[model samples]
Target chain A: MNSFLTAFFAGTSQGAIYALVSLGLVLVWRGAGVVNFAQMGQAMFTTYIASQLIQNEYSYWSAFVIALISGALLGALVDLGIMRPLSSRKNSLLLNSQSMRTTIPVIASLGILGVLKALAGIFWAGEERGFPAPVPTTGLRLGNTDLAITGFDLFVIGVVFLTLVLTTIFFTRTGMGLAMRASALNPEVTRLSGIRVGSVRTLSWAISGTASSLAGLLVTPKTNLSPNTLDLLLIVGFTAAVVGGLTSLAGSVLGGFILGYVIAFVNVYSAPENVFLAILIFLLLALFLRPQGILGSKEVRRV
Target chain B: MLKVSNLVTEFASIKALNDISFQAKPGRITTVIGANGAGKSTLLRTISGLERPTSGSITWFDEELTDKSVEAIVRSGVAQVPEGHAVISQLSVAENIELGGLFRKRQARGDLEIATKDVYELFPILFERRREPAGSLSGGERQMLAISRALVARPKLLLLDEPSLGLAPLISAQIISIVDELCKSTGLTVLLVEQNANTALAVADHGILLALGKVVADLPAKELIADSALRAAYLGY
Candidate 1:
């Protein structure tokens, strides 16, 4: 029974990190109409910055904050420097096809991932390093019994919940949030309403970057940090997003928990190698049974 | 007044607006009527800065609006209700109205609540359905919501493109009459574009008839309405 409880707590904490990463992916997809395949690369680069700061004797908290800010600036720069210029050249022969117009930007993002990974390798010499958790990792005690969840696990859950609440409020209660939603729905019409669509898009990327940075800071303590450290998390986060329906934020959270529990139970009962196979099966099931996602709205045909 | 001179817009080798020149006087309804391919929509797009003019200039009350961005033109007090009542479907009707006043100058933003209330008064149906998603509204209600959204910005000049499209005749007449009433009472400058010639001409102070990306006739509304030969040649009515 203790073992079962431990696995459950373990799954919940890990799932929270996946939820944060998935949330970032959904934000960029909704706000900019791109899948953002390079999200983990961006996160990895920022995590390295945090790692460097820690090695230089900087406090973890201050380094964490700086890494988030750097992530935001980098995200804005990516949009302004690459995506904007690419989208502006409408007369290019390579972008003539409707499919190509969508495909090219995705390809560009993959290229960005490669460049970031290469840069990280050069700067850090592809070193694997340990990250310190702010809170204690030992299990908490309830009377004489030790609970399966640690102080760090509790912190992860608390941060993820707070982030979700804050994000929800921003979207529902703020003017800029409304503008972002409006831009996502119909950018041209939003522009006509005197809102700067480009700025709103850049802001979306910034917010997305912050989310990714938060995930990196939280998850790195569980594993070693390297240029390729976040690559697996990206895949798991994407599966979570696909399960939740890419269009719905809350759905992403739910999807993350589902995958987290699945991973935990599989590890407890079966070989660890089956984890990837289980995830693949889950993704294929989601695609085949509900392509719009568990919470995604079906495309309504208005005659 | 809005003055567009020698305006030319091209899409590939085809000229969408070729050397188009016209003047829309302030505080009046100047309707541009044409057939499907007559470039009526493109003219509004160019004036609103959604599309760049290949040549010539567009000036509004001595302000050169030729090279400004869409947001800049909108901030300069010109608002457009694009064709097909392009409301943000996922947003509530009230949110859509609020979006219009979002980027208004700091001083003007104080009037948002009053402006919203006024639009509610103008279209009580929208008020009743303010919290509902805009996509759920009927076609006529959506058009009303679109106009209310543009009005919330307190634009001095309104470029309404095909407000009557896909609407029943009764609803269409009601929408146009409301616009006509607003123009007269508020002294708002209106450049109305429509394919429905008779309805537009009846409500307009002046009219411009277009064909194949060129203006064929520009005259007082009544004169253009009475000119059977010119109407037959271009408008097919």
Candidate 2:
């Protein structure tokens, strides 16, 4: 029972990190209708910047900010340089078919991922370095036992929740955010409404970059930093997004928590070697049974 | 004033607009009425920069607008309400309306409030259901939301494509009257493209009849309505 409690708390804390990464995936999906597999590459690249800055004895928060900004710039560049040129309005119409529209971006993103991975290898050189935790890792004592949750864990939870709140406010309260939503829904109408859909799409990618950077910063401290350190997390993040309904923001967070606990419990009760299999089984079940996800609306009829 | 000379647009191998030329005078409703394949919507789209022309020029207020992007054209006071009553179905009615003035951020808050108030006055039901998703509105209400959204931008040239499509007669009349009122009250120029020739000519100050991607007639609204020979030959009235 004590072991169960420990796993539960640990799962929730780790789930917070996954939520941040999954939320970024969901945002980019809603904005551009593509599952950006290059997100992990972006996160890993930015985290290296933060790790390098921290190693130079800079303040942790300052390093974090710099990393986030760098990530945003990189994301914007990716959209402008790669996605825009490949998927212009004319080309999309020519492509016509829905499968072609999605497939082209997925392929482009894979190429981007390969390039980023190569760049990371050249700079970081396959080294795994430990990251300094911004907050203390001391655990809380509950009754007769020390809970596995630490101050750092609590900080991750707090930051993730705060990010979600701020994201919600930006979408609901700001005009630019509303324009972004409109652009995603119907680009032609949004263009007629005077919004530069291209610029809005670039901005959405920037925000996604910042978010992925944040997830990298939070998660790197719990594990050693490496170029491909986030590869597994990216797969998990995609799973979370699918579980939450790919289009929903809040649903991704819920998916993260659900995934976190399930993985933790599996790790505890079952052979640790079977953890990956357990997650894959859960994902397949979710996709087959509940494709729209927990909070996703039914697909509306396209006029 | 808006002028088009020798404008041509093609979609793949098809000529959607072929060497079209006309002028839309300020503060008046100029209706383009045609059959389904006559390229009425294509004309509006080319002027607004959604569809690129293969040849010729479009001048708005003596300024060349042929090469401008859709956003730039809109910022320069051209706005379009596309066919099928397009709305951001995921967003609330109020948010959809708010998007209309997205480019004019310097006056967005103040202008949005005033414009929203005006829209509510123009269509009170939209105000009552401002918080509801735009998809939930009835077809007539969605048409009203599309028009109201375009109004929020306070555009000088409003390109309305088939506002009367897919609506009952009474509701269509209400929309036309509101548009007529807007032209009179605000001095707003409108380029209305419609398949409903009879209703379109009744409200228009001037009419252009398009046939097979070319203009067949450019006459005063009264003349187009009264010319039974021309009407029978083309308009099917």
Identify the leading candidate in terms of DockQ: 2
Interface RMSD of 1: 3.6
Clashing pairs in 1: none
Instruction: Please give, for residues B50-100, the per-residue lDDT of candidate 2 as tens digits.
Output: 899999999989788999999999988888999999888877898888888
- Which DockQ values do the candidates obtain, in the order shown? 0.61, 0.62
**How well does model 1 score by local distance difference test?**
0.90
Across all candidates, what is each one's fraction of true contacts kept? 0.76, 0.80
After superposition, the stretches of candidate 1 with alpha carbons farther than 4 Å from their true spots are A298-303, B105-107
- Residue-level lDDT of model 2, residues A24-118, one tens digit each, is 89878888877899998998999988888887889988998999999999889989998888777655465667788889899888889898889
Off by over 4 Å in 2: A89-100, A142-144, A298-303
TM-score of chain B of each: 0.98, 0.97
Residue A147's lDDT within candidate 1 is 84
Query: Chain A alone, TM-score for each of the models?
Result: 0.95, 0.92
